[model samples]
Target: MYERQNQRHVPGHTFSTPELAWAWLRSEQTLIDRGEWTPPATRRQEQEAQAQREAETSTPFGAYARDWIANRTTPRGTPLAPRTVSEYHSYLEGPLADFAGRQLADVSRADVKAWWQRFADKPRYRHHAYAFAKSVYKAAVKDGLLDANPWDIDNAARVVLQTPKTVRATMINDLTPEDVQRVADATQPEQWQALVLLLAWTGLRPGEAFGLQRRDIKTSYIDGIPCWRIHVARAVSRSRTPDGIRVDTIGTPKTPESIRHVWLPPHLVPAMEDHLDRFSQPRAEGLIFPSTNEALPFATTQQVAGTTGKQRRDRTGGKVRPPSGFNGARESIGMPGLRLYDLRHWARRILLSAGMGELAVEQYMGHRLPAVQGAYAVLDPRQVWPVMLRCSDLAGWTPSAAAPAGRDTAVLLNEMTAEQLAAAVSAMSPDQLAVLVPTLSPEALVRLLGTQGRP
Candidate 1:
């Protein structure tokens, strides 16, 4: 029950038969077993419960166990999310299936513990499986199928779960822009090309990119130059249903801020437009990078033992072939360590190197501000466009791409806001400021001073 609660599932189910209902009650017995459900039993209440207990103990535990899982639903009342329901089924089939047919009265605490010892060497599974098994017995007691839950014998608070050995945090492989470009070149599919460049260049999360639709990408002007913006609102996920079929699911983003606009640089716009022309769905609400089915993104194909499977996902630590998945494509390009997500990291580093500010980073990356800052500042897309374009230029343009010789830097100083001027001045030490002021031309000094005093 603790594990289920910890996993965000609300535990309760209705059963068809009194016997199954009793076992179902036993499975749900978590609250009482953990001392979270104790209520004083009045004389009449205790007597009535005792009577019910005697009548129900003869029922099979398996009867209720099956219904407990089968009838259970998510809080949203949909069929269980595929992954979640699948885990429950695995537990029931692997460890708890047989217990179903056994009479509630025949089970003992010692028997339950001995069964749990099977996983003692596997601490991780034992801890959770034991907790789940123990809850069933607890539910039995509460349903009047039994007078007491045996697993609670001798005041044992929980199953003795083993702890695994501790280890250091693993480091991720971060790719460079060159590495990202190589993977894009190696990829044969035009859509994957768009997908790879989309993620690497824009720093979008994989699911966020997968969720994008035609209506999400729009043209915007930055400093009078046109660029594209991607409004990310959702992501697509895959789940396996109870009968063993995989299906796509769409849900809320990982965070509220994740529903944000990502700025696409002018350089990548042509490839994007080409991707739309070649692979995009016809309707406005259609997918930008749809799978063969035109709903989810295409699966990463994999070679197997004389066969193939769409389920395989190639990442940094794998071998690849010509028609191989994302990983395979990167490996084919002589840059094997490049994961799609690695491009996101590269995008961030390149943008920061290109002179993007932290505030702009937050918007582009869809990161929420710290609590106090979030309370005070809501991002405005119009306000963020200029910084995004500057960062985009920084990431894409060569040093030689700077403004023409006719443009004057000192004149541009007058365009700086007071806040920008204050930040610039704050970055300079007194000695540096004094030395810098003396070297400035009179006209430049006036422009600088005027900018500093602006409202």
Candidate 2:
């Protein structure tokens, strides 16, 4: 019997022999001496706790992981994005499938190592799976289901899969203003021209651009200058459903930093106005870039089949054919591998080259800055307008010249002698010179200034 706090409890187990009872009594006395004595009821409670822990540890890892993902929430207390949930499901079904039958406690470091080896040819997927597994194991440890996390491989989650040198070079290749114009001109249906230009100039993600509504575009006067701004509040995300059907979900932008007002360059304002007038719906709530079915927003992978007049008249269904997409436009312009995302890089490069501060460029591109700077740095439209004007000039963009007919302005500027350039530049007004100054090299500017001082 054990007694504590005026309560007495008897042991539930029966002793088989005198020696066994005496040994148990000795152990209990030893526990008392060490100040570790507990009443019989308290011991029973501890035994129940041990049993519960055992049951939790014995839970199958796959089931635990699925449950963890299902209950996962963002830092803002919102459910995980649908695309994120789908990606986690893919990790479970693909690389982590081998652990389905194994108990949580049975997953050893050796098992993880062996599983990781299978993805030798797919380092990107391997890193993602390793991260997911680490997160799940971390949760298991927190839940008291595991004593320690088994994903102890050093730097396993830090693996940086490098792009091929050739591919990397191609990806970073400078897209000249003429090249962008060419691709936009080559883009079929004519309606997509503004989209191509917007992506290239504004550095908007395709999803964010597609999620735009007429109301998102608003005109603001900055120091008496009319500035058109794209208010990016939402984005369209594509994810595969349980049945493997791809669907688009319109939601908040990728991050809080992505929700911003991107200033439209003066040169592109006309194109935007044209797009709104011709392609976009008249309603404020209607999508700026809707699919052929105007009721639905534009899908990232949507391709409408083109039908000939004869096929339409036949009444027998026209053979489905792929429409000429961005791929066709790129191929037509002799850039077979140029991705639409690459246009964002072009915009960043142009802004940086025109002497925009890194923080300012990051703001323009809707990219998050370093932690301390991100919290404090604010982009003023007054400051952005001057830099944008310079960037527009550097990009060879003219408000009146939407399409280039003669030699490129950049080419013309390059061919002219310092004296000739000075003569030509002197004819321009103060605003034109302000726009032209950032585009000229220091050496060229010095020479032009020297020539201006001469006859």
Candidate 3:
């Protein structure tokens, strides 16, 4: 029965099923407020409630990933860089998309493991998947959506997904002089040859030589010896090129250690000076090697010259011009694979092998000492001359080669003993010596030990 509350003219209602009336009175406010008793639609209500829960639980993984992507779009996206973001997007759209849907909570470890197994065949993709998953999981964990990151489950650090083979420093060290020569020779262009020489001889990166300016070369006295001062400030390489621009650009050196002023070898000094005189524009900031039409001198000018000022006829017109100087000379000589930068590496090795002090070597290379302030204190260049001389002596150039002359051979050989020589030979492993020592003449060995010896 139902009766209206506060009714002057009262109206009453009676239910057919008493159980329904009791159920409605207990659960449904609509009937209870009217003083009526009617049961709720329990079966329909229960089914609808269950459906709502399933909808919440069954949220697609892709949807969550989209949410994550939108959240990171502003903050992380800026720093990710366009190229890096493009790569991440590629992984997401291709590989990761495979597991994007299905509630994250419902994702099993076996499912994750299976995905990894497929990626194992594609090492780069596997690496990208792992990295992307870890990043996403970290964000999820931070948001309190996930209690634990699934990416943290395995030893991701130990995993080595196959990718392109890395070029090793050890391999560079292993390269013999002949190997250097071969690489240099194969490069037909003069610029490549010069670049190789600079890298091998001075250990100057390909870009560093490109960044060199006319004024960077100063005719200065080093160790009381006339030399050229190579002030390293900039680097020019393809890395700095704009997306659409084929012209290479210049930028600051790769590291603080890279910005240095090195004293040129006396023999090389004349050639370097000659090179400057011949090729360098006298303008203060004139690139040591400037492009013919490149407008932005901040980057891209080096041994390679290209006409990219919309003036060149070549379809691919914006390439660095071939190298010049000794590289050109080498090309003329029918030598294969000679590089300009190789001279720098060769020089470093010579100085090191000649027993130059660490500080002196650091100074020679324009490298900073951690203990001292890196700015403005002039030191005597003469103090470094003796070691420099020793380096020149060790290089031992013929009339045809460019190297400084020094103290007589007999004087150098008067310094080592047989025992010391033998001990040195024994203590240094054959492999180590084979790897590091370029050549060991008997006289040089004696000189190195500071005793007269037959070795």
Candidate 4:
């Protein structure tokens, strides 16, 4: 039979005989006369619905999850980071494996709940796996493969796991400069001593430090006193290829805010200079903390393509490993649980104690501040210089009496605290006062004269 739809004749199902075709045509015409006629496309749609239902029943969760990850991208339309993709796959194979063999439509809330119990002892893993599964099922719902997501266990994805207070205290609050020095001294081969101190003093993430080149370190003169600054532009990222080869990529820093210039405390500068003199490569572009191996010291992007040079051919070496003796060093210093990252926390504490403001601390630590505040907060070297000097004193690295410009009156004036400044001015001779008077602003001079009972 045939009927017109959208001004085009649409053919219907065929019959074996003329009589059957005639009967079918008559019934369809009656329906049309009564305004109950449905187009042939309705049957086609029913068939399509049946096929979709069948497909949903047969499509395994494992296959769909893999595809989802393979095609996933960030909101900005960039492909997911290699490490993030790897991590999601790990979730699929590990905690999410129970749902893999089951059909996507067959995964019920009960199944999810029962599967979740397996991770009762692993809270962190539970959190990650739940988040991964939730994302996958969310995609399934959007794709019309599932009517509703089965991962509806309340708070399963929103749970926040907190580190124990004792661990937090040890990692941040209880750490001391003496402990930092002890760990630095304990690093094997002595070359890593500078690195240990740098981490504690500058608060650089290990990846950021690893990505540093000689050119990233620059000397700036603040009020005629030479100071050192580290320009953090990139960081080392590690990911595995499909072939299971681990590749190290030197790319942008963790965040845009992480691309910052941090003033190096004077005490830390000497150690950094020493490190450069002894260990840095001849070229400015060469890595400051290159791999210990003589060949392929810096892990370059070329390494990701399995590129090999004569040096690499001599012996295949992996990316730079963590500094040797770190575990033993922490233990030797009576802090068995001390991690390298704890040094970052120690650095933050030192900065705060040295009278650096919250905004300045955040800037120095490469942390993103609130939008309005961040835009207006400028970290000037003049402001940073005094803080660095104070940090040196707080960290027990005060310049010695014999150190160059260490005891110079000009340098001392720059480093003095407000109370110390007042005491020094009170003790100044008339000649010294005369020399300092011209440098004071009008407001300051007026205040000084008024305090001295002068009109």
Best by TM-score: 4
* lDDT, candidate 1, 1-455, per-residue tens: 22343353332445567788666457557655886653323434777777876667777776666565566665547554544556655666667666667787888877777776665576656556556667667666676567677665343345442221121111123445555666776565556777787887788877677678899988864323456888899876665666766666776565677788777766677788898999888887878877754353433222101112233444765645234556666666665444466667666665555445566566568787777876876555443433443444443432122222112222233344434333433433454455445554666556556666455
lDDT at residue 188 of model 1 (Cα atoms): 58
Arrange candidates by TM-score, descending.
4, 2, 1, 3
Off by over 4 Å in 3: 1-145, 152-186, 222-225, 236-249, 270-282, 289-351, 356-394, 398-455
Error of 3 at 132 (Å): 6.7
Cα RMSD of all models vs. native, in order, equals 13.8, 8.4, 13.3, 8.3
Looking at model 1, which ten-residue stretch has the lowest summed lDDT? 163-172
Compared with the true structure, the alpha-carbon lDDT of candidate 4 equals 0.72
Find the 10 residues in a row with the least total lDDT in model 2. Answer: 303-312
> Which of the numbered candidates is closest to the native, going by highest lDDT?
2
lDDT ranking of the models? 2, 4, 1, 3
Model 2 residue pairs with clashes:
none
Angstrom error of the Cα, residue 96, model 2: value is: 2.3
lDDT of all the models against the reference? 0.59, 0.74, 0.52, 0.72
TM-score (all chains, Cα) for each model: 0.55, 0.73, 0.47, 0.74
Write candidate 2's Cα lDDT for 1-455 as tens digits.
65656887566788889898888778878987999887866899989999999999899988998899899998769888999988888887788888876899998998888877878889888898889989999999998888899987877867663756567456556567778878887776777778888888888988898899999988864333346888999999887787666678999998888999887876777788888899887789988877765455564634321222122343475654432666667767767667777788888876666545678789878887888998898876545554555556655654432232122233344444564455445434465556556776667677777776574
Residue-wise lDDT of candidate 4 within 1-455, one digit each (tens)?
A: 36466454344466788898788678778978999877756866888898977787578988988889989987658778777777787777778887888899888999888877878888888988898888999998898777899998877866653766567776667778787888888776576778888888889988888899989988965433458988999898777666666667788887778999888877787788888999777698988877665564453322211221112322356653332456657766777666677788888888777766678789889998888998899765455665676667666654443332322444445444443344335544455556555665555444444545322
CA deviation > 4 Å runs, candidate 4: 1-59, 75-77, 97-102, 158-167, 221-226, 293-324, 400-455
